[model samples]
Target: MDLLMKSLKIGVNEKLYIKDPESSTLGKNIVEQSILMIDEMGFDNFTFKKLGVKINSNESSIYRYFENKHKLLLYLATWYWGWVEYRMVFATNGISDPVKKLEKAVEILTQNVEEDSSISHVNEVVLNRLVINEYSKSYLVKEVNQENKDGYFVVYKRLVNRLSEMIAAVDGKYPYPISLASNVMEGALHQYFLKENFPTLTNCNDSITPTEFFTNLIFRTLNQNIHG
Candidate 1:
């Protein structure tokens, strides 16, 4: 898996950046430090100027890679989804049972993220936190319609579609596969947020994880037995 990830280059939309952050050392530093800064400070307070200071470069240098902080956030979010899709494919590669495959997929999506040692520059752990906390901001904007038309969110959409297909495979008669798949993905993040900030609102504590809840919900919704 390490070798596979190292060899793999998670592609972001070319339109999302002025330059590809993965193409150069300085560009890579911009991406790496931005993830750390955004996770530490929160995306609303994060800025390219702050990131440039952290990376020891001028603010203009950061702009050479990304047009603005919003674009940078979109880049990070898109990259994270691409990485997730890779993990999903790798995890369920040989599983013949669709139920088991869908269960594993849910586990991958809802479980807390751990750092991947294969990718040294980007911290998957911190990036995951950023996604959980700030992913909605990336698209909840006035330009969202234009951005969507430009394919800035293809990676995320693809991940959802993959999960949707898995749900369909498991239960061919399930009418709301896509709707349920999307809800699982979005609900996991919301549940994590609730677990962190509003503990009283969510049952996902140290023992009761979002994974277990979603797994149970999926099987029950499809009228399938997990142990079957």
Candidate 2:
């Protein structure tokens, strides 16, 4: 898996970037530093100029890689979803049992992210936190309709569809596979956020994880849909 990941390039939408950040050192630095900065300062407070100062480059250089910080956020979100899709494919590969395959997919999607050493420039752990905390900012705007039309969110939608297919594989009769799959993905993020900020509102914590919660919820609903 490590060797495969090392060779793999998680592709983001070309329209999201002025220049691909993975193509050069400075561009990579901008991505790396910006992830950390956004994770630390939150997206509303983050700026390309601040990222440039941290990377010892002019703000204009950052713009060369991205039109604006919103685009950069979209780039990061797309890249992260692409990476998830790759892992989901790898983890479920050759698994014959539909239930087992769906179980593994849930685990991969909801499990706590550890830094993947295969990609040294971007930290998966911090990027995961950024996605959980700030990913909505990338799309929750008046321009979302246009951006969606422009394919800015193709990777994310594809990821959801992949999960939706896995759900359908497990339960052929399940009527709301897409909704369930999307809820698992988005709900895991909300559960994580609640676990951090409003512990009482969520049942997930160190002992009871969001992965376990969602896994249980999925199979239970499917079983009932099948039998009841």
Measured by TM-score, the strongest candidate is: 2
- Candidate with the greatest lDDT versus the true structure: 2
What C-alpha lDDT do the candidate models reach, one value each?
0.90, 0.91
- The per-prediction tally of clashing pairs is 0, 0
Q: After superposition, how far is residue 163 of candidate 1 from its true place, in Å?
A: 0.9
Compute the lDDT for candidate 2: 0.91
Give residue 187's lDDT in candidate 2 (0 to 100).
94
lDDT of 2 at 199: 98
Question: Over all chains combined, what TM-score does candidate 2 have?
Answer: 0.97
After superposition, the stretches of candidate 2 with alpha carbons farther than 4 Å from their true spots are none
Q: Per-prediction TM-score, please?
A: 0.96, 0.97
- List, residue by residue over 1-228, the lDDT tens digit for candidate 2: 878887788988899998999999998889899999999999999998899889999999898999999999999999889988899989999899999999999999998797664586888889999999998898899999999999998887887898899899988999999999989989999999999999999999889999999999999999999998
